[model samples]
Target: MNISNNVSSITAHQTLLNTSANNIANVNTDGFIPKDTRITDNAGSVRTNTREADNNGSKRSQTDLAKEIPNEIIAQDATAVNVNVIKTQDEMLGTLLDIKT
Candidate 1:
């Protein structure tokens, strides 16, 4: 009946999506080194880390469209799955209460 893990997963994936979208938006901005996002799991809880790229001394934005696009898609899918799981758990809890009454 615990959904804390799913909630954390959804939060992590949302962060990932946000980072990817930011990278894509800054692709045309010069000297913008897009940040990279990673998901870390700690004791069944999910965490997101966003880090800036190394100073490569390049004025061009190093954000790659090919990678960011897929990353965003994957994040979206992960978020959706966690959301669905949370919804199902809520329904099941409601059903259990109904049975008891």
Candidate 2:
């Protein structure tokens, strides 16, 4: 398994979670435009980018709390899973080394 790729995926998810949190936090502020997370696949790895959203005059903050909250929760869960996988890999490597010794 490519640990580097897994780490990068976690980072990408983290960026998404942060962006969602920021959007939810500023949901009530006037003239606040929600930020969106964009993911691009670079070869086999992933890259995350955040951008400000365009707004219309009729909109308040351009944030939907209902959607943002669920997205943030999912990102957080995905990050946790990646972390667990890394931990499990490390344990397996350690076991192999122990056997070799």
Considering every candidate listed, which one attains the maximal TM-score? 1
lDDT of 1 at 66: 95
lDDT of 1 at 94: 95
Q: Which stretches of candidate 1 lie above 4 Å from their native place?
A: none
What TM-scores do the predictions have? Answer: 0.92, 0.88
CA lDDT of every candidate: 0.91, 0.86
* Clash totals in order: 0, 0
The RMSD of every model to the true structure, in order and in angstroms, is: 1.2, 1.5
Model 1 worst lDDT window (10 residues): 53-62
lDDT of 1 by residue, 1-98 (tens): 88999999988888989999999999999999989998999988999889996768889988889989999899989988988998999999999999
The lDDT, on a scale of 0 to 1, for candidate 1 is 0.91
